[model samples]
Target chain A: MKRIVQILDSYSYGDGMGNHAGALLNALKARGVDTQIYAKYVDPRLSHMGKNVAEYVPSQEDVILYHLGAGSELNRKVTEYPGRLIINYHNITPPEFFADYNPALEANCRAGYEDVKFLADKVEMAISVSAYNSSELARMGYTCPLHQAPIVMDFSDYTKAPDAATVEKYSDGVSNIVFVGRICPNKKHEDLMLDFYYYTKYFNPNSRLILVGNYRGFEGYYLKLKKYAKKLGLTNVVFTGHIKFSQILAYYHTADLFLCESEHEGFCIPLVEAMHFGVPIVAYDSSAIGETLGTGGVLLREKNPRLTASVMDQILRDESLRKTILEQQKENLKRFDSKAVADRYMEFLLGD
Target chain B: MNYETYAPVLEKAKAALAKKNIPETAVSFCDVRMPAWMGKAFWFVSGVKRKMKRRLGK
Candidate 1:
């Protein structure tokens, strides 16, 4: 009998990678596959979900699927396993983005490339979350079989009722423009702030921009953004730094527009969430944004704050246009139907 | 709808841009670096933790 094990550095609580890993674990188990999660740092709350990698005993028939995103000692250990090994490559951010913001992560990401490139020849198969990441793997010389699948997610979780208090507090009828992502340099938070500035200065004064994400490792960058917002003399810009899942649900529930200006994304999951909530999206066309959006929202060819603000305004004021975008988003979202994605992942995971 | 359909909206935005004052949007970060000794100490502690975990069979 063979077993499949998913290995990662950290199995966190609610971040994109953690959620995808957790969902993939359950999806595999549901299909009666003997699957387990092994990680270096397991969140205390999710300790039952996985065990420490130090205790992961290797078997000759075991298929090890290593999730590679950052530089970690675990990345080196997985290469020594004498069995079928797969590299599930989640794109790593370029180290240049973090040179000034975080020295530790910058070093980790720099070494991460070396780690990834070193494993290129060791793995029997490589899988990525998007075509963008697949192309990146190819560029890095991953010649083994390569497959692309959206991160496994149970979208039904989004249907859970948002916190009532949160929804009520933020649903004061004022327009709310929202962007949900980690407060990292690559996310281009300043660009979102500028669009909000132009929108408020010219179009609607009753609007507020909500940025919801954790800024623990990148405190310097977070502080700089706050200082920059003050320098712009911007008002009504809310930074909800790492809130509860229900509160995130509430924010998405109250959002009138989902705007993203991220320069790089393995696959922007928030775009799909915004579509799930029927919030029209306006994102810059870059990296995997276009592929993930799939005609679901308005894609800007360039990062022009004034133009983005106008497009946002038009989508907000023109009821017909907003309806059309929402309809397209609903159709586009079907591509991520949980069962379809899970089956696709199974084919890749269980294939020859 | 294709991106070109938003051309009129872009034109409107361009017209509006000509009338309003735009702020400089470039951002700069604070120069924050940890001393080499502290970094080495942190790495030493992490390596110890990994060794301890392995020894404890966890």
Candidate 2:
């Protein structure tokens, strides 16, 4: 019997890709598949979840699933290995998004695209998390077998008790608007602030926008957004820069509405997260937001600030409407149920 | 569920916008620059660490 193994460039706790890989590993193990995860870079916190990719000696019959997100030497070296190779294509950001922010990131993204193209014909199959990404694989000339599945998410993780201090701090009867994602250029945090400016100024003065994510490498963009908020005189806008998972859950718990104006997303995990938490979503329709959000919440066709604010105001003020949206989001979340998704992965990979 | 459902609400918002007078604030795009002070040291160290990690294939 051939063993199944997963490989990626980096594995860090709280990262969406790393979490997805971890969940997939657990799911495979539950099905009794002999598996392990190998990563070129493993965060010290998640050291147990992955082994050094260099230590992974591949045998001829083993099936290797390469989780491709960025450009790395690991991506290139894996092509020479003797095994059944498959590409788990997590769409990479276009280098242009980083061209004005970080040159190194721009180069990595450019190289990521090059690596994808390089492995196009080498892999036996390509699995993408969204149709938008699948189209990119097709455009990249992947003639091999292609399948689409939602990223494996362990929704039960949200059910864990959140930080008591976080819940006590933010749950003060004030309306809280939340968006959770890394503070990266592609996320378009400025658009979020603009819409939020309209919301707080005209709709409700007691509201605050809570942006919970890490801003380590993207501090320049973070600083610009902070300055922009100050110039607009937007008060009560909070930037919780990379806190604990419990603290994140607390934000979700206290949130009244989840608003996302991100311009690009491979598959917006936060939207599903908002659904799991029963927070109504109001996201701009771009990339995979529509498909991921489904009929769970309202989708904006464009980023008209006044219009966006109006939708948020309506959702917040109308209890019945809020209830209806939450119900729909709950229904939509059934698609991402951990067991169902794991079963789907098994079928997609093993042809059951 | 659709845009038409919010037509009445949006119309009211548009009216409120016309009556309320506030100067439009602009938040222009500014390119990111390198960090300063201790931040600069942290950035340099992380950059070097990433490069070393890639080279070591670990």
Report the number of the highest-lDDT candidate. 1
Clashes of 2: 1
Shares of reference contacts reproduced by the candidates, in order, are 0.21, 0.23
Structure candidate 2, residue pairs in collision: A40-B58
Residue-level lDDT tens digits of model 1 in A244-316: 8989999999999999999989899999999999999999988888889987898889988877887888889
> Fnat of candidate 2, please?
0.23
Q: Quote the TM-score that chain A achieves in each candidate.
A: 0.98, 0.98
Worst 10 residues of 2 chain A by lDDT: A343-352
Q: Write one digit per residue (lDDT tens) for candidate 2, span A1-352.
A: 5577889999988888899999999999988988889998889888787999888988988788888888888778888889888878889998898875578889999998998999888999888988889999999999998988889998878889999998999889999999999988899998888888988987799999999998777766777788788877888899998688999999999999999998888899999999999999998989888888887888888878777887798889889888988898999998888888888777767762
Question: What TM-score does candidate 1 reach?
Answer: 0.89
Cα lDDT for residue B20, candidate 2: 63
DockQ of 2: 0.23
TM-score of each: 0.89, 0.90
Q: DockQ scores for all the models shown?
A: 0.17, 0.23
